[model samples]
Target: MRRMTPARRILLLVAACVFLACTAVPAWRGAKIAYHLHTARYLLGQGELAQALSWLAYPLQEQPRSAEVHYLLGNTYRRQGNFDRALRHLAKARQYGWRREEVDLQVVLIDVQRGDVEAADPLLDRAAVHAVPDDVAVEVYEALAKGYLALHRIEDAMVVLDTWIQWQPRAVQPRLWRARIHERENDWDRAAAEYRQILSVKPDDVPALLGMAGALLARNEPVQALPYFRRCTELAPDPTQAQLGLAQCLRRLGRGAEAGQLIARLLRGSLTLEQQATAHYELGLLALADHRLHAAIRHLQTAVDLAPQHIALRDALAEALEKAGKSRQAASHRQQAERLRQQEDRISRLLAALAESPHNPDLRCDAGDALMQGGYPREAVRWYMNALKIDPEHRRAHESLARYYEAIDMPDLAAEHRQHATQAGAQPQLSKPDQPDGLRGDGPPPTPKACGPVQDQPPLQKLEQRAGPP
Candidate 1:
């Protein structure tokens, strides 16, 4: 090759710089966006949702049309209970060429939460089963069960769990959840039956042992409970609860001294507030049985102090106080107990109202408030989210959620909802890419429509295609 002149060499250097600016600079920026997306995914998996969203912010700003970015954002919002934003981003992801099967499944899951079972049924068919991963299938069924449970549709929850059990016979979680539902309904026989089935497979499962023992104890069959409780204490990761259950069984079986000793040991160990309260209550009951009136009053009073909302604790204290001739204090406790019962009754009535009118945003908000007052903040969250599902800009629901997030130390979520609460007529809109329009923040809130047209096939039959009878 011929040697270049100085002027030509300078020109060539300039051209090379232009070429690098044209190709390499954009490539570097793209790489940085991809790195942010990857970090967001990792943070999401780690349950650091706030950190994940922060990491996603940069990529979302830089690559507004990126399918992967929107998809990740969608999932993060889904986990955060911001289903409206989640659906919007998921729609954007689908519009930008993300996998349709996954996007549609997510949409169906949201519909399920909206109590739109018909919309979910078509997508849950066995023919489409191979398109969804096993984990996704599990999520779908779990969402169905949880949604129905939240709506107090216990029968539907049972049907879903039964179908899940049929599909995954060996799954421990489903069986455990089913047992819990049974326990909730006071069906001790059925609850014990479920636990027995679980123990038949995983004989040493600590939860199963404890659950079986608990069911028998609830049925006042402590003789039958004793062996399971003993086994549980031996195998449990934390034996405190199991030992407590054993003490309860011992007390019920007329072994008060043994129960007292076990309870004393339990009190010496570290425990959650609720567990501590339970221990004190059991100790008080044992003392009362032995006619140690003063000791019974002390222990029961401590339990009531620890768990003031416990109706049983309040009742026991009232009884002890009345026996001790403190009629005034006993009357006060009885009145407090009545108030607690009324609060619980109000919550149940609100939930029943919600079940009858699932789309009523005001009813959902009221239910959430009632549940919060009744000492169930976690369950209250579902109602608040349901209210938001119906009316995204609902002031009371947003304010309640903001308070909840603040209490939980999730400042980002708290602030976001606070902002949403203040935004009177608008939502945060996504900038349009080159594709068709996704959900618009400025558009009117979705109409409060009933769950889609009912399927001709029965609920269980909708999921039974290709699978054997449920």
Candidate 2:
């Protein structure tokens, strides 16, 4: 070999530097895209849809044809109930190397969510026949069951849950859900049997224990319920419900003093509004059993105030008031109770209509309106959320949520929904007429930041070195 000149050596060095640059830039770009994709997936799993959408935007802008990116973007949109955008991205995913088998299940889920179950049926039938991965099978089965229940197709929901159990006998969720359906039908014996099966598999399962106790109590077998409720109280982190059930059983078994003391202790602790109402109701029942009419009336009235929608509480309060010779007060409560019952009936009719026309946002809104009138604002929120899920731009739903969030003192969430309601072309009727629409007047809604701490990324130099100068 000839001895190379310094200039030639320098030329070779320059060429090597150019080659490294060429390889490194693409490698670094690919790594950045991958990082964004992985972060988006994590955010999606965390239920941070807004953050996930932001993260996905980067990879999508960089590699619009990337199959994984398109699939993930499709999922993000699907979760947001932007079904048109979801389907468009999913089509792109299929066009760019994602298999039809993997993509079809998601499409089925979208159809189910959109209340197009008939359109999803053929795809579901195909999925049932094929051997899919266990995770995929679980997701499909769960979605089908939920959709069926939403449509009030009880038999179909049962069939889906039964199939889920048959395929995955060891799975607890399907069995638990099956038991709940039985409970809903008032089949205490069947519910108890299902709970027993779960307890046999996982002896310390608090939900199963609570279910067994509730079923036995419904069957008027407090003797059988006591031990289960006791076990649940021992196992559950928040044993309020279990303790209440235990107290109920004790009172029924002629241990009213013990039950009253347990309830008194429970009332002194921190609890949700619902839990506090239940505790008060139990205490009222104990006082009533002891023939303390005034005490009973006070406790029951407090329960009625806390949970205004509970028919039983109103009736119980009226009963105590009547016993105390306050007939006028009792009559007023009874009339209010009747009005609530009628409103509930209206809500049920609207919900039944929704089952027939599952995608009807107006039906859902009507149900929410009825629930709100009946003083069930929390439950009404769920109905509004359901309406939004079917029709993202439903003005009434956004207006309802804005009012709810404002009442709860969540200004940021309230402002967001208010802005949405405004953009949907309706003037939102704020609960407080003087409340300012900050997002509306302040230019635009604030951008959502990515959730959690930022993860460190490898420098381009390190990534290039790892790729080794293609």
Candidate 3:
């Protein structure tokens, strides 16, 4: 071929350049998408959720219809606690060919968190009806159960939990939760049975041991519960609750001297306000058991001071003050108790009025509370069960029934109720109210309660604080 002219040569060069540009553009776009996707994942893993969201925005703009991108974006938003945004993205993902059980479960969670139980219910019902893959089905049911629990629909929670157990029998979480609900319902026997099941699966679970011990003690089998409490202490190494529990068991077994020694040791150490209060309370119990009235009064007084919210502690202090001829102080405590009792009664009456209308499951649960306060736990159980029969997914009913069982020394029944409670998605009970000690005291002690103990040590101070002070 002959040499081309300058103008022709320039045109040929331009054409070649244009072809290369076209090829490179698509490759560059693909590479950019991949980079952003990976960068978003990396940032998410690093806990930089905001940064991950920013990185996701670019790829979503380029590939707005991409299901995977939207799913990832939803996950990031969920992790950041932005349930609304997360639900929006997840809904979009589902709309774009990402219809799966996992996605449905996420939607359920978002709705539950947003307190839109009504919206979540249909989605859960649909997911269950559609028969998604096995793992997805399990997850979906679990999420639904949790949603019901959040709404305090305990019976509904139990049905879902039972479904989960049927699907995955070997899973321990469902069983553990069941036991907890039983504990809440005061079904000691049922709670014990569930705890036993947990112990069978994982022999060294401290929580299960503690729960079992508490159940046994509640059943007036302190001797039987002692070993479990000791085991809990052994496993926990430095568990204050376990220590206190062991001490209580020892006192019940007529080993008050040893229990008192343990209480003294606990008192001498630095402590959290809660621990301090508990230690003083235990010491008071030990002293009272031994008929050391003065010592008991001092310890009980310290406990009341440290935890003003503890009605039992205040009541005990009032009694001790009365015995010691401190009528004025006793009267003050008695007045406080009466006021609190009246307030509780007022709330119970209001709840009862609400329950008089048969349409509200929540109101029924609330009414059960009134019955329980009225010292009719068995009657409360009936109301709770009635609520559950009305709505098998009723959370409050399950919780109330579990507590009732525990109260009646039926651990197995308690466990069954607790299982449903967990399925209903009830939160773990953080603290239990201090119950009454069987003994009485006479006079106060000489020592002033210590304060400002080391952060990591046991408690010594007795600073009065509000209810649920810890």
The lDDT of each candidate is 0.77, 0.75, 0.68
TM values, all candidates: 0.63, 0.58, 0.52
Query: What is the alpha-carbon lDDT for the whole of candidate 2?
Result: 0.75
Every candidate's CA RMSD: 13.6, 17.4, 20.4
Record all residue pairs in model 2 with backbone atoms less than 3 Å apart, i.e. clashing.
Answer: none
Candidate 1 positional error at 82, Å:
15
lDDT of 1 by residue, 1-470 (tens): 99999999999999999998999988998899888988987776544567799999999899899898898888778756689899999999999999997887777777776555546656655424334445565656666776677666565666777776876687676798899988876899999989989888879877789999999989999999999999988877679988989999888888889989988988888989999999999999988877788999999999999998899999999988888899999999999999899998887687566545555677878988988988889888988987776566787799999999999999999999999888833655443221112423554322211111113322223432321111
Looking at model 1, the pairs that clash are none
Q: Which prediction has the highest lDDT against the true structure?
A: 1
lDDT of 1 at 333: 97
Backbone clash pairs in model 3 (N, Cα, C under 3 Å; residues 3+ apart or in different chains), count: 50
| Residue 118 alpha-carbon offset, candidate 2, angstroms | 9.9
Off by over 4 Å in 2: 1-132, 143-156, 356-362, 381-470
Q: Residue 318 in model 1: shift from native, Å? A: 1.0
